[model samples]
Target chain A: MLHHTLKISLVAAACGLAFATTANAEEVTTERHQAEITTVAEGLNFPWGLAFLPNGDALITEKSGTLRRVGTDGVISTPISGVPEVVYKSQGGLLDVALDPNFAENEYVYLSYSEADPAGGPGNSTAVARGKLVGNNLQEVEVIFRGAPKYESGAHFGSRLVFSPEGYLFVTLGDRYSAMDDAQTLDNHHGKVVRIWPDGSVPEDNPFVGQDDALPEIWSYGHRNVQGAAIHPDTGKLWTVEHGPKGGDEINIPEAGANYGWPVATYGVDYDGSIISDKTHVEGTVQPHYYWVPSIATSNMIFYTGSEFPAWQGDLLVGALKGSQVARLDLEGDRVMHEETLFAEAISGRIRDIEQGPDGAIYVITDDRNGQFIRISNADD
Target chain B: MLHHTLKISLVAAACGLAFATTANAEEVTTERHQAEITTVAEGLNFPWGLAFLPNGDALITEKSGTLRRVGTDGVISTPISGVPEVVYKSQGGLLDVALDPNFAENEYVYLSYSEADPAGGPGNSTAVARGKLVGNNLQEVEVIFRGAPKYESGAHFGSRLVFSPEGYLFVTLGDRYSAMDDAQTLDNHHGKVVRIWPDGSVPEDNPFVGQDDALPEIWSYGHRNVQGAAIHPDTGKLWTVEHGPKGGDEINIPEAGANYGWPVATYGVDYDGSIISDKTHVEGTVQPHYYWVPSIATSNMIFYTGSEFPAWQGDLLVGALKGSQVARLDLEGDRVMHEETLFAEAISGRIRDIEQGPDGAIYVITDDRNGQFIRISNADD
Candidate 1:
């Protein structure tokens, strides 16, 4: 950003101490495990995304558009009704919240958000939707897919969705960051990712389905804002993570028509730290089965196949919002051999969505305006 | 922003508890005020702008571009040397710092940052420089004034410099938030308010000096991101505060070429709450001697005229960052009438610059990486 602020102002003036602790710690032991954390639901607002429900309750959402449900006994519930309007500024709102691998029998639910320019066009993008739920409300909603040429910068709205196991659906999108060169163009869908079919159509084997210059629901393009996504129960693939910019964050695994180079081959640098691409490997793009340099801004991701930390099953976890913690990783098949972090100092705030529940534990939520939810578990059980 | 997040998600779902305490408080009593906050100077990092030195030391800055110097006996000094390079991401770094209404016959100083885009052109604006300090180091430097058509979104930067009374220098900018229609364009300087001269020249009575399509160091036009500016020791006028979106923060006073209607007459709404203008009063623009509806996100302000809080003298204090606290206000001439807040529980963090200290005490800093310079005197001094 200005040559990383003049190299941290001449290395913090030759280290005479410019400080850097940002505390944290409610209980963390990690050698292969320890955790502890708790909260389990306490208010909630900037909560952004979290799913769950086969009756264990959960839902969440909030960046300001509300969706709430909570209750595995921690209480919460209210605000759910129809849910759609969102743009909640800064990082745009009501983002991510899944459910519907036939939620029992199609009780559906989806969500994602940021959408405003419904063609009145002044700026705003990233949409998604779908609904059904019924009881707390949301019966027949349906927006299903948006991300296009909208701008007005309320900062990037990556949106993160994820369905696939063959049910298709994916989503992701984001380079709305003043449209970073339309994240390597493709007839437009800002940073691309697309895929669709939870009723939003598209998906004919996606990846530019019938490209007339592309956009048939592109599958992957230079993505510079994909806030965490997941699948990999054993590699049904589709991984994602995104953010970067002042330290490239990435994760990726997209596939299809792939490009994945953002602001051209970035390994991060540019939130004014400038340098957007000294080439973190270009030429045909696609790298990063893991990245993150000074960024922990990553947001939602899952995969641990739940069962409460059997040394963290197949590991992955994620959710960070500027290093506020969770991370985990440790996979193997697609890389990321070891990473850890989890509740670093016990959820100080901003982890935003982690999920695992069904009783096995883990959950999380935090990006505040009162946000908390949390859970973790197995401090040696 | 989405109808204020659907009326706070239907009133926090009819108040089932979504939480909103945010804490704060090291000791406050307020009737006429009690105050007792100390921390003197703790490590530092995101601590943007402060400036004291008539020998009482102070100086600060550090939005990762360093400049230290802290002692009135609080000891911080270490990274000062010459201070320039900044654009430290997000709110862009090393911003606001002043001194030199002939800083005792030209020791100068002045700062304000975010630059980067010096014609190689890509994006980044907001500049200002000046130097000369000579002790912890600075000697000569220069830069002067930049702010023009840059565009890359690190979020609205609206720096804050102030000096006026006739010595001119003002500064205040910020429509960089995706250039909200270039804050009512006047040939671009993003959201205007210029007036220079401590060597940066252009101040032939400003207000668009010789307007050949405006830009002769402008001096006021629609705003939308001004991070606090001051100058009314007795109506020498100037005021300012800005940053509204999801409840307009404002304060204004500005005048000169006037305008001030932001995204065209706003009381704020668009942080995804949408509705940038139902017109808070259009005709010739200008209206807001005070505003703030759920946005204590203000930052940097001062008018108190110090003496260890005579009943807060001319009272005006301010410094907020998403309401982390210290509002105070009170005034009557420019009409505010009463406000209060201050540490709201005791600085839970994010206050960012608010000075007065030449021994009349008050100081404050916060915006964290670990930041904390604080002082706030008179518990009954």
Candidate 2:
């Protein structure tokens, strides 16, 4: 068990008392800092994902199947047209958007949405598509990748997208509600992270490419519902955060072909207080870097590499939906040293996504019908 | 929409750097203070309610139908023998425990549990019972009140118990999952706070005592699952916290005959993102004293008047199950002035109940199979 010996100092600014520093070695001291919050955009319909374009504008995806562009002057554009039709059901819809790595040359953008099956069944699947940005509309759009064996449930569509330094695109997928058993199988894309080339082709060196009965696009498997994914700038590794059933939210540095346990070896029980699995560890499954008991309902993540906040450089920032705050995790190598909740009292809504602006400011989008885009910067500035 | 202008101060204790007090009048400033945590008891099965006895010992109720005694020296006694048979299903079991107002002479102990229906149907209800505590067993246990129209679902049993200053017992009941519409109706006790005499009789002065259609014991109606309740030490008014559907956990001072809207004027949407009610206010409904937009999953509550924390006198302390911390609300005459999370980094599980001990210290019980009873005191002592 991990024990936290927290000592907080309360000083009255008016008293001007000379305080003594307690020399307790195991004590962790956290200095509170304030940030100036500026509203960037308002009246958004549950903005889900945000990505910075090369031209300093941002593309924001609303869960209600609308994509809008926000200019540098905090002006929101009208909903972009020519996007693919999405199943805008519960926890579905236009999920994540990302700019192509060669966006400056190719003018391409990628999107992940809950796709209604062509057979017109009740089932829906997570599908990734790419398009050329032509003014306010996407042109020449084409589906890149689609999850297999679509299910009928509208919950747990883990559709966050991140680009690796090696230029391959990584897409996180959920266990599709009642299909958690598929997470342990190699035949389906449910509850798996897939890495693919921009044109929807699996790379030759993919981890499960040659394995019998395994999907060639699978990078890592057995995730429950990964909503956050970011590349560690120094390590060039992918760090992801996933929501657990009832309790156990986890953060993991998913390695190639690693089996991150879900129903087989979870730290969480079922939602109805029944045991999903009695074990927290298994022989071949990988343990998480950090797991939160009594889940924070983690959303999106980013690794800070900005100059505006020197003290927070290289720290991992996770947006918490249930806790309704931005969690700043200070890491000592792979282990988390301290965790602090930022903008908790200031932001009243669920934090859906977080991004670093080009000018080194922190931008966050809230999840609500009247959600707002907020920017936070050093108050001293 | 509410806006928060928060400014936090960071002071280096060793060097008293002549801090400038920024005079932002609307800015809320919160100072972090740590407490010394001492484990009072451990290895209890999801301990729910805690009450300090006159002899300085503590009595705790576990949700799995066992009640135990903790001595002043932190030794836990074996389970007391005579607890009524409780339905230990999802979110149901032996719940809140309290002492009679005249415990010295009467030696009566009050308990709230999910009572299985007498007809042996697939249904149960929240029932209150009273008995004399004799050594290790409850003598002559008798049912005092049982909620009508027992429902099969165990999702929301809202069984917190509080005694009014006038010596009437107040019991909270839930909408019982599929019975939310009953919250708006007074014909049943599905979603209401009921005031009654100790011996299963409705108080004659109850709000709906003489009404033909309404239940005579109903004090207030239109509430969801109310998990917390306490009386204001100064005003003697009842205050409660209820879990909302998706967002909008609310704190309300429920007045007699007042409708605290649940399924009608909620700030929350349904679990599938469907609207429960778009209006946050209705003509005859009362607004919440305060609300959490993205809910903290509030549980038990208390109004502190303890001398151990002089600055916190008359404030409301709420145990947050989802946030895994205690929320201290500094109140200025019923309106919340400031809110701060306490023991967030120290307590690692869901806080189920909180109480002020006879010695003025704070005691909390965690909700888990391996739950713990933790006592918090001033670190300076």
Candidate 3:
């Protein structure tokens, strides 16, 4: 274990040094128990999200509104038919995918996408839907949740979905551009984490369920753009990683009815250098569990419980878009102890999503026109 | 004119609000002026640089190592032959193109590219070469200058070339990823601007011409990655715009032998959220004429002296990569008076390069796999 720790640290240090030196330096992976990286699929058009099935195949969502399945042997299926049409604009399209907790019996698959407003407005909203998977196509699909107050912007449709132990689905939403204040308000679904039943019904115990003006689906608010979310294995809590403007990308444990101060209080400034807030702290909002200063353009994340990598157990693995690496955050209770960047040199493009495979290997998806699905495993096995 | 200013301001204000709201909002251009945006050419692969010929043709350099010409009427010619083999990698490859001061007589065209190291090291360096253009082929091509101490990273090879009215060529070099410390040193060329004659010989009047142990070609030092450069119309000074890591993108008047301060004095933190420098200001280092926090990922720049945009005369127009907008900086003497972001709604993808056309219109290239060359003119005209 000590040897593995040293090797991982050296790899992290090498990434920092490598970035400081060459422009075309091939990402060099260090020996952490001789870990092996293998390609699972290639030629993906900006693959955004991923989920696994009991049969060991994986369902991947492309940002261009296609769904694909990758076999255990790395054979990628054609786009699954009956996938809903997506907005398919800048940063919008088919997003996250996950299996229903009772997938063996239900065969239900959940998806998040940028849904064009039915009212023909200038904007689209993040929406969640579920369908029974029959072979390569979806059957009997139904819309589950729709983000409110859709604006014309095609950016920041935070729509990652995670199911709690109690089978409640948590849908993450972004603050639609030009509606940042909506992140602070309960009247809209923008910039919020909403908890609901599998059939799209709001839970009676939801944080804002009794409020007259607030949306009953809102579990928490004040998020900028939560792209990655995962249920903590040990605590069963929902933890998220969000993209900050220039800096201040954050990791948070969003609780019931909590406010995660955004434009009102942030470590980041406006893109034009104007101050967003006078302080990083606000009177009534919760502080982030951890925050990044320069920002890595964080994407999807997962709490690892896999047995293949003993050292990484309980660590939070998050994908980085702009920084082009996987960041592993070691936690001591709720506070982050250390962050070690993995495969910075090995992964060439923006990391879009991360997953722990059924066989205990790690899988990551890159977001690019020529994207790839990469799997990392212990070479000793 | 007041109406135009108000329109521009409203557009700029919209951008600020848009950024505040949606992380993925498509920049919506509100018509401030009767500006007509037309496609000049399409289906280019990440066009990086552009230069106009005397014969009403334009030379374009694709980042993927191809060069082509576009007619005044927007017909794209086949890839030109006889260009040197470039080490096409991330942020490297065929970059800036410029015409010689005596192009009519010499028929000389200058090209900058990431040249693979002849020593077979896993590295490449920025090189500038000149060749005579003869019927879609370069004849008598000879490399003039090669950046020294080549390293293996492919992120920052700042290769913008601008010719001073005095007939000297200015070559911008990036702080070859790991060699940022060399930016403050006189021993190597990384992260420094060098001035040379058309034949690659160092000009005697260069700042370090007689200095001990310093590369005599050095004009300015301590630039991180200068992608945009233009000569001031009146003062004939070399003005540049360079990318900052997170925030701290800057515009500078690079004085001879002056230090601009990279890792030593930066407003940006490391991508991993670590502090890059303890200070944004230090003694003896030059401050930027203008800086953007949270970064716009600035690319190429041009100082407009065109008659078509009368109010924009003497203003600096810059291409933004991340913000996907054209930034217009209004200057009062050396200090920036105001900034207005234009064409944000019209252009999509990363703006790689900008040029002022012979007809006094503005042309820009987008840095996408499916990039396009766009022209902007007064819609009324």
Q: What is the lDDT of residue B367 in candidate 3?
A: 93
lDDT of 2 by residue, A69-156 (tens): 8776556777898788999999999999999888999989999999998898888999999999989999999999999977898988
Per-prediction DockQ scores?
0.01, 0.01, 0.01
lDDT of 1 by residue, A178-213 (tens): 678878979888887888889898866776787687
Clashes of 2: 0
Task: Summarize candidate 3's per-residue lDDT along B153-261 as a digit string, tens digits.
Answer: 8878997999999988999889986778888999888989999998999988888998898998899998999999999998999998898877778788899989999
**Residue by residue across A1-381, what tens digits does model 3's lDDT show?**
112222221112221222111112122333223466666667678999999999889899999999988776556777898888899999999999999999999999999999998888777899999999999989999998888877889888997999999999999889875688889888998889899999999899998888889999999999999999999987899998888877678888999999999868876766776766746668899877777766789999988888887767887889999767888765545545345677876667899999999989889889998777878877553
lDDT for model 3, on a 0 to 1 scale? 0.81
Compared with the true structure, model 1 gives a TM-score of: 0.29
Candidate that beats the other on lDDT, 1 or 2, i.e. the better one: 2
What is the docking quality class of candidate 2? incorrect
